[model samples]
Target chain A: MSGPKPNELIEKIDYNPPQKGWMDVPVKIRKGMYCYASNPKSVEYVHLPHARPWNPLEEDWKLPDNWKEIVHNAFRERLDRFRSFKVFMDICVRCGACADKCHFFIGTGDPKNMPVLRAELLRSVYRNDFTTAGKILGKVAGARELTLDVLKEWWYYFFQCTECRRCSVFCPYGIDTAEITIMAREIFNLLGLNIDWIATPVANCYRTGNHLGIQPHAFKEMIEFFVDDIEEKTGVKVEPSFNKKGADILFVTPSGDVFADPGTYTAMGYLMLFHYLKEQGLNVTWSTYASEGGNFGFFTSHEMMKRLNSKMYAEAKRLGVKWILGGECGHMWRVINQYMDTMNGPADFLEEPISPITGTKFTNAKSTKMVHLSEFTADLIYHNKLKLDKSRNDNLIVTYHDSCNPARGMGLFDEPRYVINSVCNHFHDMPRNTIREQTFCCGSGSGLNAGEDTELRLCGGLPRANAVKHVHEKFGVNMLATICAIDRAALPPLMDYWVPGVGVTGLTEMVANALIMPGEAERTTNLRGEPLPGMEE
Target chain B: MRLDELLTQKKTAIIDKWFDVVADTYPADTAGFIKRQKDPFANPVGGTTQKSLTVLMDELLGEMNHDKIDSFLDPIIRIRAVQDFTPSRAISFVFSLKKIIRNQLNKSDFNDHRILAELFEFDLKIDLIGLTAFDIYMKCREKIYQIKANEEKNRTFSAFERAGLIKELPGSGPELA
Candidate 1:
């Protein structure tokens, strides 16, 4: 009846889509547009509430007859549980400040990716069920019954959000979209409508102690593989501790660091750093039981997050370590900084994390007693404790990508850069808006990193990739150093596809490359085994 | 008689019109953002437009070589391949050139046999370039799917490995052994 068909050629776009009625707009679930249903094994492993076979693209989702009431009850329960969820639901004035702030919206031009609109997808549901005005006036009041289509829309858009909280920074009221997104996902979990990428990991981390489901032996062997590769690259053999009792510190990192490419190199960075610390007689132990740092359960629900988060403190107390040092990760930092203490914390058993070498107490991390790897490195550099050779990175003109979790969630902007600048001489910033607090997500954050939904991930990653492309062309920056493990795993392919020739690494990888370690071989290549430019054997 | 002359002479007008079509692909506010954008970082979708349009205009004027056309077409097409645009919508900008050329040429100009023959040749080249863009667009979509497939394999890699589905080199982890 109106303009072009959604599939037709470009015409004028209505940016201000009518606020009150999204039900009038049909859901566009195209081929290659949605992910497969959760594997029953993954769902059952977690013993999630509602367990039934369903597919997103199928005509019949086989929803329980009371699915609508289930959603309403779950929403009311969440609203009662979290005040922030209630506030986020109640307060959006719909001022479009966050309209263009999302990487997904910028990349794909999807109106639903707009943070405000994405929130409104759920907010509309809130009005339909609980609000009195919504009950009285249907579509006019922006309230529609919780139909199957509406539930599907919630799953599509809510999963699309990385829960990056970039919109929260720009919101005038400080209404976090991540709050609503987490709550929505929690409600989805209540119905057993889980995605495989999330559910499998949740089950894996629950049972085997890591998301990758690497058994204890395999987890140890994976690191040993990295240890061998590290020795091949640097000629420095390392014997990292595993589940050691009475160690001074407990070293924890995302298992992605142990399992994947590029991330393995960052894991090598941690090994070499820990090896150096070990030679200085500092005892740091790695635990297979608390193997994961990046929390997939955080993507699922708060209770699941608490269940997963309890491992770190439990393992720390069991091992009798004084403190914990978290390696490069994004969401892990957000969980550690914002939620870890309140959820399963109060680590009174452990002392405040003081750098054994630097003798500098991490006064800022006083409560949780967890220090970031970059902060520890920065302190060591500030005291000139490590012999750093910035010239080792002469071939690389690097730029720092502040991963969203650490940037906005934890305010960890300078520590990683301080470490990068100390080791790498040539470094540049992407742009003011796209860095630090305004950092874009890797698009594959949370559990959306699964291969089945790769296009969506790439769409969300466009803004970050575009920003990297700008610096690569303008500043001749060929290296992207980040503090997040997911960025290390995700940004390599992102850089390869969007802006070729740009390499990605953790800050510590660059540090290890620049480190003039004692009894190490002449450096000819970076940790990835690529021949370092300007240096010939 | 020179058909390319009509397009070359009206290059600015043609490009200005083509710019409108490309601009319409984005939201109106985004279109405004593109118009005002000088920094490529701030507005990359807007930034790549002028350089690409200029090359297409030059290709129409001179020899319409695939390599020449490809140099400009690949970047924009690859970008749009991952964008919200469908395959047809993403490459529709190529055919829009025909409209501009057809509008600029008068009826009297087409009546001359030489001009008509040249016009026929020019139309063929545009058609050829459209075909070329279609290939690039499909290849890009394939690449996106390829990446997705690779990632999917990786997601349950350990599961597969544990299930004895993935073959290993046997000596892959000699150090661990």
Candidate 2:
């Protein structure tokens, strides 16, 4: 009775210099007297003239009432089905540690984007739906009804989250708000409330078994296209590992790497690396099926997760490959390291991976026995199997930006870096928390692969770019290297935004470039110097 | 295959039938009695033909020493007190009142008919407004009903976890991670 009213508990005790007097003023009084009545969207409208992929409607497209009921019930069922991990993380203590940790919050100074508050919006609902206090006192107890408005708010903000799980690593309770964010998105998605940027790919993946929605013919065409690109760029007569059965390794990478940006270069690198391995009599078979590995739907729902992941296993079974290898994608590995075993199977199709040359068993496997390509390459280097020139990478100052999935999600902090340092002599680290488990995002992860919302992307990318910028300012880290495909897809555009001259490259790309050609001397030019196509000159 | 049609077809019918049965059994005259009882100018029950509640209200009034009902005894509280003081008799009274109100409700056909039914059944011990306790109670009741209606949802996630859709993080617990 004596304390601040229940509604006032979340009141801004901390305020800016001008608002000290207003902190204690009840929200009712503030609203009544025309206080901070400015619209939030006005800032975006005014500041971001070029923000493409604009949302024209506040409300999502609705289905018929009967259809709406079905959708709502389906979502409710999914909500009901959430595991302990879902419940545990949704009950986060509103600690501000994650607030400052978020790049979007730090860059834009928008309190709504702060990971802690972003989490609280949904956490309040969980408390209301599941807790005793919530049952006894409504909003006063920080429990609000699940109105259409709240769901819409969740759709907007949670999608903005990127499921980076960067906040989760720092949380005292280890609350991964990313999990809740994904769940919220999944619920919205069940109702067919989809945005074009992320959802189109998801629907594509569902329909065509790949996010790019490449037809089976187009998928094969992409491989051939990349092979030709490799021939043109590196003068290597590269061949795709297409439909080859019973090979020692079946390599798979993010399809984006095959189709776009620096990922295309990584795709080229994989081709060259496997070509090198092929010349060495390594009996490896690799092919791209509809990319079921890094399904954006994994970020949405279990149904989608099942639909997406089932393809890779199903494909692997069809091809009768001995082992499957995941390419450099962040969340794909997060799924592989964290969810794959639980999501899909005994994986009878996937044989335990072994070194093609050494025949040594890959004994220490993560949740799913599938090996991250970086981990495999790192192991190859550790065994002193890779013949390389460290000086070939000397032209560029290299720094490692650890992909979250491989580093924190899969506890693969050292392997990729070890491989990088082994292959390249000038390996450096970005500022603290820029590598390993504490890495920042490329801003376009978790299916935020949209051309619109570039402002939001830049805002999220600021923290990461700022870190890379510090290295560029001090040690002159000219080329940023990472292992995940999403990072490869995301970081290049971000580098262009903040530090104009700096570039991003995948670790495999660098390794492939430095790789000693079977017959020719490895002629590494300004290896990190020449601007790759699509990169700023 | 459409989940809404399945749930609505089954759950909605069950809820409607239950509502009708409960509505038919609730009292109609209680609201009129409460209205008439609260007026100070009306004759106080005394001497020969006093009903039990009339005597009780008289004593309660004497205790409060007021000609008119106190503002502290708002409509909800007064109604609750009257109902509480006449527990055995109140059940019969409420049923009679429900019978009278059913025809009117049918003619009106409001979407919030369920709200009225719930409000009518609310216990005297419940303080509905102190902190939106009424809404909270309703939500809790709804959640419980939801769990009952779709029992599979409550267990599927855990089963999936065991099935390996989500790998539990290290160190939380068998359930939490």
Q: Alpha carbon lDDT of residue A57, candidate 2?
A: 49
A1-537, model 1: which lDDT tens digit per residue? 786784364234322333333456667675555566777788888778767778788878777778888888889998998999888889899998887788877766667778888888888878978899888997788777777888888888888888898888899999999888899999888888888878888889999888878788888877887788888888889889999999999988999888776787788888888887776767998998899997888988898898988888899999999999999988888898999888887778889888899899899788888998888999999998888888878888999999998889889999888888898788999888889999888988878776667678777888788898889888999989988888887887687678889988888888888887788998788887778766756
In candidate 1, how many Å is residue A132 off? 3.1
TM per prediction:
0.90, 0.64
lDDT of 2 by residue, A119-213 (tens): 76666665676667876897777776666566655666676677878877888887777777776766555455445555555666666766656
- The DockQ-based CAPRI class assigned to model 1 is acceptable
lDDT of each: 0.81, 0.56
Report the error of model 1 at residue A455, Å: 1.2
Best by DockQ: 1
Model 1 C-alpha lDDT per residue in residues B19-56, reported as the tens digit of each score = 76676676555555566656655456666776688887
